[model samples]
Target chain A: MSEQGYHVAILGATGAVGTRIIEQLENSNINVASLKPLASKHSAGKTVTFNGQTVEIEEATPESFEGIDIVLASAGGAVSKELLPEAVKRGAVCVDNTSAFRMDENVPLVVPEVNADQLKNHHGIIANPNCSTIQMMVALEPIRRKYGLKQIITSTYQAASGSGQAAIDELIEQVKTYVKGEEMSADIMPVKSDKKHFPLAFNLLPQIDVFEEDGYSHEEWKMIHETKKIMKNDMNDTELKVTATCVRVPVVIGHGESVYFEMDNQDVTADDIKELLSHSPGVIVEDNPAEQLYPQPLTAEGKRETFVGRIRPDKENPGAFNMWIVSDNLLKGAAWNTVQIAEELVKRRLIK
Target chain B: MSEQGYHVAILGATGAVGTRIIEQLENSNINVASLKPLASKHSAGKTVTFNGQTVEIEEATPESFEGIDIVLASAGGAVSKELLPEAVKRGAVCVDNTSAFRMDENVPLVVPEVNADQLKNHHGIIANPNCSTIQMMVALEPIRRKYGLKQIITSTYQAASGSGQAAIDELIEQVKTYVKGEEMSADIMPVKSDKKHFPLAFNLLPQIDVFEEDGYSHEEWKMIHETKKIMKNDMNDTELKVTATCVRVPVVIGHGESVYFEMDNQDVTADDIKELLSHSPGVIVEDNPAEQLYPQPLTAEGKRETFVGRIRPDKENPGAFNMWIVSDNLLKGAAWNTVQIAEELVKRRLIK
Candidate 1:
């Protein structure tokens, strides 16, 4: 490996996840020779700090990827659809944080701890799983390897930050209004472009994304599809049954999930599940109930690891179990996952 | 109908839900001969305002029910368990807001919109369903009555107020700390006395109540069990499967749910579901995708009716449908539900 760092470009550099990627890279061991921040025309010319230096955001285009060794894309699906191929075409290895390439046959959707080996088969581009799926997989992968997973049902308590910066601002404003005994207003959040904005400061919103053809919201669909993509290797001829109910809460940063699963084997106890998760990479266990130890979003804010707690066997179903998982949505869910992939690329010598 | 209102007693009169009950009863047409506000010994000397008059808080006791025609109880489960039966024995009709008697076979669980007829069988006590279940049932009951319901899967986005006042205070303090870039402390919420508090200002917490034997939290279990108790015409039939994931969010007031259900009958379109909800009593349908109209917590805050939106069919299951439901947690979820039962008691002329 050369002492000189790799030339890296961050697409969607103005997004919530993009900012985290910059923070992760700032303290990372990876040597960065040059940093390129790219976004839409609206964000072009905006300056972002990287490694203590300001980098001007440029309009993302095919030519912008030339000479870049690794590209981290956190743009939306449409942007990634248009720009990701261009980055790959310019000979840069791409790690996309959008839903565009997650289920693509050629792309490997990876969570470093869960399936770092999948990186070996990536065809120039890798996809990050959905934010909700990423945290669940991080906690469940270790259990799956040890106990063998059969089915998983999860309900997500997602934060406003999962939507974007504007949503976070709206929550703050709404909360202030609530405290001041003033009428609160919400125009963005739980699907901003959606007709009515509800005050999330002191309330909950059930729909996370737009509704698809089926009754499920797009967010719920993402969890269902992304879980399959992440755990694809574990599924044999049988399809992985992943049922999810995704909801948006007043929380601004972290995402929490209540996950229930059935194991192929019944001997695995809740204690065993807790032990496995405690030692799993990038996972923290806080499941002692006597002293009331547990993982919470309040404690998970700004942290990189996924927190697991409340592990117990399902009393009604012999082989079924339940667990709680929490993590900073912007970190492990998006930015940190992308940076971890970048780190793995350096370790595996996948990037020049 | 008596021109003079009955004597009313409010237990846990200063609580989150209790406060809403006072607000609702203020403009109510129900004749009130006298108002008695009862609390614990600690708060016995305190005072709460009711309809422009300062009502002294009296110590809650078995004797407190004397001369009371209707007692609305919102204290903790223990308090309700201890005082409710006493209130009933003393000739006061008890409308309990706690989970104490929800599953008691002798007690008839009521969600007025869904099973107003159940009030006929109440033997001095009527149980209110869980907040999450209440809103979902209100929205789905109309469809279920017409289509013959089969199964339901739901996830809840609950507010801090559901956990009581300490949680609300924690959220406010934490948000202020977060805005100032300072580390915040967590002493309450996501389960008070639980080791390690997380910041609620910008996070999601999956654990609502303490974990039960089958990996489900007590809160989730309540939703599942209460739904059956409220909807089952025959208590012996356990075939009405309802699975729930209950989570606590940073929101302070409204409770939201993402619900999916499959009907015994098919051919029901999302529009049909919307039509059913639109006409349901105590339900307001706001679903319109193109113009971005949908139910949101912010909009639902302070509103008595349950708001339903995002109606769509599940692509995977032909007869299945999905929708979003939101309501003020303190109102319909607790206070309003309790007060409605009291109103029902009068309408039936059940109160002797």
Candidate 2:
């Protein structure tokens, strides 16, 4: 690796998250000597603008990472599994946006704010946590630091972009069809790999990703396991309980989570938790109910900060409190988080 | 009330729920000799077709209930508070859908499937619980009865129709504006009484009603209080604890809820709970995650039965289980529940 400037390569450069990663790099403070855009063979001929320069994407293969200093991967789970190992073997530090390496014991799942120090433990690959888990960790890490966290029950209102660009296109197209009083069709949503597809236009689907054997969807399990791995580091610890219901709403960008959590300290008030989050990094508190101020998906679409509001102490459980958290699933949840992890690797000089 | 037939007056007949009540009556097995459509003076000239008959709407006043045997009220709370007692004084047994009499000690908050027995004790007014509460009551009453429920943690994804027709129109108009790349204006969502209005087209609003003391929104409080009243007539008994976070989504008709409940009996499996709900009245168990069969708002839009799915035993809490419930907010949540109450009064021969 060169100290003067770094040669960066973006895997899956033509996809939704990959394009956002390139945009994040353009707006970021990272010094770049050169840029390489790589995508699948079908998308290799496409041209994407990075830092106001037209860069042609090449077909992604093992040889593409020859001199790359850092790799930002968002192609999907299959691509990441195939190429991320070769990229790592080629001596490039990869920050993967897919779930391929997130649960790997050797790979550190990093949110930067909560576990930036985990970057020191990366074995050539640092896994970027899921969009939903990353935002929840950002909002909850501050409170969990002050008051010990015991349990979490979360329900997500995720946007179409989390699925891919095609899901967004389908949502917009379905809305157009609905307005025209035509029959709406769905070919990609909830879980594209699954048998049935449901239209998310003006509807709420309770499934995200495929269902697991025990009835929880894969998306829910990701939040459960990823949160545990990112927070505990000790995979066997069962002290912190987590359960999630991941749902897809009609929004296009941001994701909203209704989180109910119980703290070890029963005396912690909502104001106390609010004050802690207000001072935490990469977190914004928008909880003023009297003036009707709260975090909303539209207002938080392009923002990199996790917006939290509607803080209320649960009356039923003594140590429990409820809050509404919103963040751009593409930005803070995926792209920016990946970029932040890269920045941490640079700040700590963790890249080999 | 005569055994042959009954004269029914539908308050707020030109509104969303009011119109649905008329439709339900037309399709119901209950004998209706006469139908009186009543609304504000503005809607007096409007005509509504009931059972294929074009009926003219009249201004709702105390005199409108002179010959009315049952008054189905869905107007705003203020109108219900002012005119409902007047209608009751004219010997009409009123099933009010507004929150005007819900918290009144003498008024019975009845979800017919759960608390139709309490309808006999109503002093001229039977309170139809909030739309969110009605669906939750239908889904949970079965479980509570079979397993002995102890606690409830619910998060609602409510539809536009829950707020009335203007909110539904605003949601559609906002979607159209968003599609046209124009600035979307919202004058009726989240809370029209509040100073600020956020677009519900591609966003979610955390606050359904105005904020109450202790940081819970008014809509959340209604779910908390109304559930207690319908489930347990004795409010002093604090055995059942209910907490809620109500959110308004972009869906046009149905309301979806993610519910986590702890049962008094710890040995009940997820299948046991599902089987319990499958046999319960007015409940439809749609829980087959392996086949991608689950309850969704789009699928539950026009259905009268409350759909329950995604039943999973909680790994953290021994006695707890999580489930998803959805139903048409306009149908089962308001109009259907109100009409069912009237049918109960008819069956019991309590109206005079």
Highest TM-score model number? 2
Q: List, residue by residue over B1-352, the lDDT tens digit for candidate 2.
A: 5666889999999999999999998878778988999999999989999989999999998899998899999989999999999998999999999999999989989887888899889889999999999999999998888889888999999999999999989999999999999999988888998888889999999999898977899999999988888887333577998889999999999999999999999999998888888889899999999889998888987788999999998787889888999999999999999999998898898887
Q: In angstroms, give how far residue A312 of model 1 lies from its true place.
A: 3.6
Best by lDDT: 2
For candidate 1, what is the interface RMSD?
A: 3.4
lDDT at A36 for candidate 1? 97
TM-score (chain B) for candidate 2 is 0.97
Clashes by residue pair, model 2: none
TM-score of each: 0.86, 0.98
How does chain B score by TM in each prediction? 0.96, 0.97
- Residue range B182-238, candidate 1, lDDT tens digits: 987887867775555556666666677776655677888888777777777432564
Any idea how many clashes model 2 has?
0
